[model samples]
Target: MFRWYQRAQVCYVYLSDVSSSVLEGDSPTSLRRKPAIRKSKWFTRGWTLQELIALARVEFFSKEWNSLGDKQSVLLTLHERTGIAVRALEGSPMTIFTIEERMLWAKGRETTREEDAAYSLLDIFDIYMPLIYSKR
Candidate 1:
């Protein structure tokens, strides 16, 4: 899955609980609301951390699939909310960041399976480990 996302041209991030509500204001940015994007559940999943950093291009959509923005457009919001540097979010070489910093990204994320928290990081660290799955 990591390889697939890495080679893909662009990834679409769907915010199921978010909406592009229009709010009137004087500034030019007074078009689509930004608060909801910050509150999305997508950022809480452990798997999403690797998925987000691995991709070069990521397009965001609202609940109804409306064009919310792309990675470049919403870069600041993503950085502020995730505490991830812009360079990482921009798909820089993973080696640029220390292993400790990388690990911090997953510190508070939640994963369903016990092994999956570690599994999802294989791609992030460029470590290849065959997944051995068996029925419980």
Candidate 2:
């Protein structure tokens, strides 16, 4: 999956109320009052980290499919929301960052299966281990 993301030209299209409000006359505060991007299920998923890091390009769209901007325009908000460094969001190689650093970035993100919290990172960390379903 990580390899596919690296090789493929990926664009993330979000049906965002925030992007729509920004397009309209509403202030970011008004958008904030609605559901935040931070609270999004995509951001909280463990597997999403790899996709975010591996993809070189991403696009944001309004509910109506109007282009808001590229991912670069909102790095600060993404950093603030997800605890991910702007450098990471700006296409820095994940290899330059330490495992501990990556783990810290993932602190609050969750997975329905507890093991997936670690397993999702296997490719990001360039490590391989048997997926042991049993905790013991």
Candidate 3:
């Protein structure tokens, strides 16, 4: 998947619930009621980080197959929810952000296996480490 993503000219992202229904008025109370993209299981996955960053051109879609917007239009909202920078989201030529910065994005995210948290980032970081499993 990583290899394919790297070579693909453009990537389309189907954000199943990023529609206007999820976004109400701009009032603080309404904003509080707004659906946060981060809360979605898709955003919480370890592998999704790479998918979000590795692609150069990413198009976002809503649940009803409507186009929410392109990368630029949705970047601020995405960054707010995911804590990833616009630069990284833009897929710069090389990742200028540190590993710690990248890891920060995954802080609240989850994986069924503990090792998957590290394994899913191997390709994104271009590094390898032995995978180990624990009863915890």
Index of the highest-TM-score prediction: 1
lDDT (10s digit) by residue, model 2, range 56-119: 7876666666655556665676677777777887778778888788888878778889898988
- Model 3: per-residue lDDT, tens digit, 27-135? 5533432254445556777777777777766776666666556566657766877888878887764358787887788787778887787777776677756667778
> Of 2 and 3, which scores higher on lDDT?
2
Query: Model 2: residues >4 Å from true position, as ranges?
Result: 15-23, 26-39, 129-136
> Which 10 residues in a row give candidate 3 its minimum summed lDDT?
29-38
TM-score for all models, in order of appearance: 0.86, 0.71, 0.69
* Model 3 ranges off by over 4 Å: 18-41, 93-95, 112-114, 129-136
RMSD to the true structure for each prediction, in A, is 2.2, 4.3, 4.8
Candidates 1 and 2 compared by TM-score, better number: 1
Collision count for each candidate, in order: 0, 0, 0
Q: lDDT values of the candidates?
A: 0.80, 0.69, 0.68
